[model samples]
Target: MVPQRKLLKVFKKTTYLTTFLLLCIAWSRLRLFFLNVKSQPNAVEYNGGLIDDIKLMKCYRWYKNCETLYAQSAVHDNSFVLWNRVSKNMTDSSLYAIESNWLYETFFYVHLFNTNANKEDEKQPLADIAVSRDPSLVPLTVLQEVMPSLRSSDSMMGNKRLYYQKTSWWYRFWNNPLPTKMNLMNKWKHNNDILWSKIQHDSCLITNIQLYLGSNFVESRPFWKEIIHELHNEDGNSIPISITRKVECGFDANHTFPKNTINNKDLLQLKQKSDLKILQLSDIHIKGNEENSAILGEFQSRIFISRIIDIERPDLVVITGDILDGNKSVDYQTCILNVVQPIIRAQIPFVISFGAKDFSKYATQQEITDFVNQIPYCLNKNSDSNGHLTIPYNFSTIPNDSKDDYSNLITQNDLAIFIFNSKTSKRQFFKDYISLYKSPPKLALAFQYLPIPTYRLSGVFPIIGQYNERNLLPEGFDNDDNLINYMHEMNIKALSCGFDHSNDCCLQSIHDIWLCYSGATGLTAPHSIFMPPSVRLFKVDNIDKSITSWKRNYNKIDEVYDYQYIYNQPKQKHTPSN
Candidate 1:
C-alpha cells in the first residue's frame, strides 16, 4: 500500500510501461515495510508472492475442471451455443477474486491509467480506486472509519447526514489513505521492535483478514487463513470450494434480547393447500456487451441455473434483482433472456424483482420490467395499482401432481410478492409502504433490498471491537421498532434479498419472519460482485404456515447437496383453524 502523497513511487512516468507488471505487483501488496516477523505459534504468515501463488492455484484448478466439463458438454450439443461459455468465466473470476489484484482492469488495460498523474493532480488514492472487494482483508480501523455503522433504531428513510459523512465522496476524496505495515515500522525505527509486536500480539482472527497495509493497524480472520493454508497444501487436483457450516450458526449465545422483548406465541396457523417450492437467485450480474468473455461467463450461469431448476423442480422462480450489470451494456436484455429462457420455455411461473442496481440512468425500472415481460411466462408487471409488479400469491391452487407441470399449479389469489421501486420514493404505494402499510396485503412475503439488521455480525466473524454498530436500512422510517412493528402488523412471513453477495440468514422472531439471502448467483464485469455461484431454494408450507430454506451450490463442492433447512420453525397446529 503506497502512501497517497507519494504518487509514482515505484514507476517513473517514462518507465511506467516497462515496469507495468512490477507496478501492479507493488499496487497488489506492501513489499517495502513488513519488518517484524513475529513468531506466533499458529499464524498463517503472508507475503506478496505466497498470497498470489496460493490464490491463483485455487482459481486455475477450478477453471481446469470446468474446461473438462465444457468439453464433455459438446457431446450433448455440438452447436457453439453462445451461452455455454459462461462457467469458465465464473471460475476465472473466482480465481481473480481471491488474490484481488489480478481481477483489476488495470492488469490487462494498462492504457486505462494516466502515467502522467503527478502530485498536483491529487487524483483519488489507489486503494480508494480499488476499494478492496473483501472488507475482511482491509484493516479494521479503516473499515471502522469508512463503512456505515448498522443502526438498530434508525428508520428505513431518515435524514441521515452522519450515515453518509464518512462514506461520502468528499470525505473519501479528502482522507482515504489506509494506514499500512510501513507506517508501523517507520514509527518504531529507533524504538523496541519487541514492544510493538507485544502490543499487536498474535491473534488469528486479527492478523490474516488484512492485506499488508503499510501499517499494521488491521487484523484478518482465522477462517480466510485456513482457506489459504488448505489450498497451499493441496496438490491442486481438487480445487477446494470455500464451503461448510457457518462459524457461528444461529444467534450468538452471549447476547440476549431486552426484557421488553415481545412474547412468543404460535400465531402462524396455516390451512396450507400444499408445500410450495420456490427458487431464488440474485446478483446474476451480466456484462456480455462489454466483452466476449463476459458473454461466456454469464452463459455458464444459465446452464448451471437450468440444471438446478431441473433437479429442484421449484414451482416458482424469484430472481431478487441485479439480473443485469448496472451499466450501459447492450447485453442486458440478452442476459435476462439467457437466465430465465429455460424457465420461460418451461412455462414455470416466475417473477423478477427490482433492486437498486436494476434502475440506473442507463436502464429504468419500467424498461427492466418490459424486458422480462417479453418472456411469456414471466409474471413481471409495471402498474400504478397495488404496487409495481406485486404478484399476489394464490393459496387456492395446490401443488397438483395431477398436472404434468406442477409450476402452473399455483393460481393467483393474494400472496404478497411485491416488486418495490426503490428509485421511486415519490410513488404513493412505496411512500406509505415505507412509512407503514395500513393493513397487511394478503399473506405477506416481500422481495426487496436492505437486509434485516446486522445486530450480531461482529460476534460471528469477530471485527475490530465489541460492538459493530452498523445498519443498512434505507432512510425515512421512525426507528428500528418501526421495522419490527411493520412485520408484526403485516404478519410478514419471509423476505428474500440480494444486494450483499455473502450467504447469511437470521430469524427475527417478532412474527417469525425470516431474513433469507440468495447470495451472488452469477459472475459478471465487476469483480466486487464475485462469490462462488449458488442459488437458494425455499419450501413454504401453507398448511402450517412454516417457511423453510435450503441453499444449492453451483461450483462449490460440498458434502451436503440437498435442500438443507436454514430455518425450520414449523409451528405445530394444536387447534384446527376455522
Candidate 2:
C-alpha cells in the first residue's frame, strides 16, 4: 500500500476541490437564470416616449406582457404587483397593495421623458398614456358609473375592500418616495395632476386609511362606533374588542395635593389583589443640576409621591437602573435616599438595580446590604454582593407578603425577578443561570445603558480592554464573538437597561426585550426625554404561573408636557360634554 497518511491527504484535497467546483456550477446557473428572466419584452425598456393612441395602446400591451412575465418569474410576488398596478390605467384594488412600491420607478420614467428628453418623442407616448383614460376619450361621468362601488364603499364599515383601501394613507404613500433622484425618469410623472388627485380623492378605495389617520397621533377620528359598525357589517362573529390600556401612572406637573389626608394604612389596601402590577421607572439620569432639580422639584418631592399614591395605586414598582447623575459622584446613594426611600416608606414594594453610574466602583457586600436596608424592597443584599447568597433572594423580605403562610416563595413560585447589575462593563454573574431556568411571570435582566457600540456613538467605556485593577471589563470585552457568547449563556430574552436618553426602542430578538431609556427622573442635563419625562407600566398576567400578559403605555408624561408646550397651558379645552 502507498503510505496511509499520504492517502488521507489526497482524499482531503479531492474533497475541497469537489466542493469548489460545485459552488462555481451553482453560481453560473443563478446568473443564467437572472438573465433569462430579465430578457422579457418591456422588462428592460422605460417606454418614456408618448406616441399617438395607436402607438400608446401598443406600449400598454407591452407593459401587460412585462407584468405577466414578472409575476410568474419573480420570487417576491408582492414586488410584481406593486410595479404593474401603479403603471397608470391599472387601478384595480385587488391588483395592487395599499402601498405601490414601484411608484418611484414608474414615475421616474414618466417624468424623465416629459421634462428632460426630446419633447415630440417623449411627450407623444406620455400624452398617449394620459389621454387613453381621459374624460375626453373615456369620459369622467362614464368612468364614475363604471366604478360606482369604489365611490360609495368608504362609508361602509368593515367592508373588506373598504378596510384594505382605508388602511393605507395614499397621501403619505405618495410623498414617501425619495426625492434624491430627480432625473428624466421621474419628471413626467411628477406633473400628472389627474393621477395624483385621483390617489387623494379616491380615499374610499383605500380601506384602512381612516383607521391609520384616525389614530391618536394622526388627524381625524374614525371612532370606535364606526369601527364597531364596520365589524358588524363584515361578519356575524366580528364584535367590539377592548384591550386593557396601561397608563404610565406618575405625576410630573407638580399637581397640588388635596387638603384631605390619605393615610398609608388606607393605601396598603390596594395591593391585596392577585394580579401582578409592576411599574418600570427606568433611564433616570440624576445629575445634580438646575434641570435635574427642576425634574425632581416637579415630581420627586413628597407632593409627587402623594399624587402617585392617590392616582396609580400600583402593587410593586421596578426602577430599572440609572439612578445616578454621572459616574463621577457617589452622591447617587443620597439622591436615592431622598427620593426612592420615601416611596418605599409608603409600603409600595420597589426593586432597583445599579445603573452605569452606580458601578464606577464595584459594590462590596456591606455596600449592597446598606443600600437594601435603606430601601427594603430592593432585591440586592450584603450576601448577594459577596456572591455567597443563594440563587434566588428571599421573597420574605418583600413587605406585606400576602402568601406568607406558604413557604418557599422564591424556590417554588413562578414570579421570580432577576435583577442583573449591568453597571459594570463586563457581564454579570446572573447571566450564568438565566438559561438554565424557564421563563417566569417576570424575568427582568437589569443592566446600565452601555450601548452595543455603533459607528458614530462610543460606548460607556473604552473598547477592547482586558479586566484590570483600573478597568474592570472581563477578558475579550471588545470581541463581538465574546459579547454574543456571554448573552447566549445568560439566556436573556430581552434586556432592559437605562443608559440612553433618547426614545426607548427594541433590539434584534424573539423576546420583547426593550432597550428602555426613561430619560432623567433626576437632575441630569446631558439627557433629553426624546419627548417627555416618563415611566412605563406593565400589567403582567400569569397563566399557570407563566407570564402571559405584558402591556405598555408610551409617552404618557410627554403627552402632558407636549400639550403644555404647544398651548402654553396645562390642560386641553375639552371636558366630557355632558
How do the predictions measure up, each by TM-score?
0.42, 0.35
Query: How well does model 1 score by local distance difference test?
Result: 0.41
- How far residue 30's Cα lies from its native spot in candidate 2, in Å, is 99
lDDT of 1 by residue, 1-578 (tens): 45743566544654776678666644422321121112223322221110000011111222222111111111122222111111111213333122233322100000011233463442211111112122223322222333347333222232324212223453245322221122222211100110011111111111111211010011122122211111211233322222111011121222111131111111011123466677888887765342457656776777777788778777778887777666543334445655776675455667776665564344455556665654445565333444355444446643333223323333323355555443343145534543443444446666655454532233234221112123365564222434545554555567667666655344344455655666678755232333466677777666665566667666663323434343355456898789
- Model 2, residue 87: distance off in Å is 80
The local lDDT score (0 to 100) that residue 73 gets in candidate 1 is 12
TM-score of 1: 0.42
How much lDDT does candidate 2 score?
A: 0.33
Which model scores highest in TM-score? 1
Q: Give me the runs in candidate 1 sitting further than 4 Å from their true place.
A: 1-273, 290-292, 359-365, 382-387, 394-415, 424-443, 452-481, 507-511, 525-531, 543-545, 556-578
After TM-score superposition, what is the CA distance of residue 178 in candidate 2 from its true location, in Å?
A: 83
Off by over 4 Å in 2: 1-273, 287-310, 327-333, 359-369, 386-412, 423-493, 508-519, 523-525, 543-578
